[model samples]
Target: MQTQPISTIAFTVFLLLFSPPRAAAVRPPPNPLRSSCAQARYPVLCFQTLSNFSNPTAKPLDLAQAAVRASLVRTRALSAYLGTLKAASQGFGPRQRIAVSDCVQQISDSVSELSKTLNELQHLRDGTFQWQMSNVQTWTSTALTNGDTCISGFNAAATTGNVKLELKQRVTDVAMLTSNALYLINRLADSVTGKSRSNSGN
Candidate 1:
């Protein structure tokens, strides 16, 4: 067999050792929100609502925060819409007016609860993980209840008007969003606590 010259062999070895590493195949980061939301009840809505607030590499806590923020926006919008309906209550009959008033109050309560949930989520590091997670879960649950109460007020009253139906429809959507957010928050809480336990074990 013919042997390569020493200089040629040495140059080839040098190139092999120093040529810029083939850039490791740059993989796009996995979309964390999309993956998590895929398991949500309203997968499409959850993903669409949250994708605007997160990047592909967001962690569970980040995705949970995004979900809370989205729910807050929906609650605030519902509150404002209810306020408008309340303002035009002059045209409503006594029963309809009562329903509108109740809806306005309930929606306002939902806004408050959602706000609290967001605050709790932001301050998760202020307390024990379980305690903070419990507060977030409670507040989100209350917000969902408030949305249901707003819709139920219309249902209980003998109001067959379009306003009642419209308000119910709108609040229903908010309730669904709240429910989805709560699910994400629960998942995040569990994941965070699990990681803490695992690290402590190590």
Candidate 2:
């Protein structure tokens, strides 16, 4: 007979002595929002943002819309903040002022794009699902691109370091939300298309 190591036997005894009941060790029930958010590029942010409105009955399209709405809300708030910065830009260097102004415009554009995406998602029709989903994809992608543009505008050497850092962090947050929205939208489109194909086959 093989002899077990003392440490191994001791560890086994420790487990038996201290481990919780089997029921307590069982995995917790799955969260639908967590499951849905896993499909996004930023799953943690996605879950956090959607948790405010997510329900047990929320479907893929519902989650996508909620994500876009969250992005839109954040973008709009950032746009307002940028407006204040642009107004108080007298203290900034000429290049910094220009960068701030441009960032404001870029964020404004992002707001518009996200608004369109949310609208399209809300009114999605099965008859034109593909066409409408294409529009949503384009708009969401544009929104993300606009945020990137805003961040790039601050890359000039003349930009105020603190302002640049703050704007970058805010824009990055909105961009992550938008990116997660796009991921969910794309997943919704793929799932619908797959089902259509399966139905046709049957």
Candidate 3:
């Protein structure tokens, strides 16, 4: 075998020493929206509702905001539907009319509360995060309660009809969406605050 020249050997050694190692293929991070929604009670609903938004790779705060906005959209749609039904049922019997009117009002209130929650969430910051999150939580809870109240109004008045049942179901569905949004918001708040404290500790 022929031996390489000294210069060649030195060059080979230099190449070996300075050559970059083969990089392992890195897996992309899991979809944050899917990961976060997986923690919700209504994971499918949470995912479907929020996935419609523009960004899926958003941070926790952004995801929470998106979820709240989606919830608001749902609540507003439900409120509008209730309003139409209430208007059409103007000549309905006293009990039915009263029930429908109450439902409209309750769903409207829920929409308002959800809108407020969204507003609060939009302004959340690391410094006043906890308090702001608390307000968001309270508003979301109230929105959920309002939805339940809307359904209860129909039940209390013993209102029955295809329209009544449909409205109740729709309101319940919106309320469930709100509930899932609230869960995501709480989780995001905890995650962000915990990470902030951890970084501070270091």
- Which of the numbered candidates is closest to the native, going by highest lDDT? 2
Per-residue lDDT for 1-202 in model 3, tens only? Answer: 9988999999999999999999999999887677878879899888887788637768777777888888888889988898888879976788888988888888888888888888887776767988888888998999889888877878888877788778877887888888888898888878987888899999
Query: Candidate 1 versus the native: TM-score?
Result: 0.80
The Cα error of candidate 1 at residue 74, in Å, is 1.6
> What's the CA error at residue 10 for candidate 1, in Å?
37
Question: All models: lDDT?
Answer: 0.83, 0.88, 0.84
Where model 3 places Cα greater than 4 Å from the true spot, the runs are 1-29
Clashes of 3: 0
Off by over 4 Å in 1: 1-30, 200-202
Residue 142 displacement in candidate 2 (angstroms): 0.5
Scanning candidate 2 in windows of ten residues, the lowest lDDT window is 152-161
lDDT of 2: 0.88
Q: For residues 65-107, could you state the per-residue lDDT of candidate 1 as single tens digits?
A: 8888888887888889888988988987887788888878887
The deviation in Å at residue 72 for candidate 1 is: 1.0
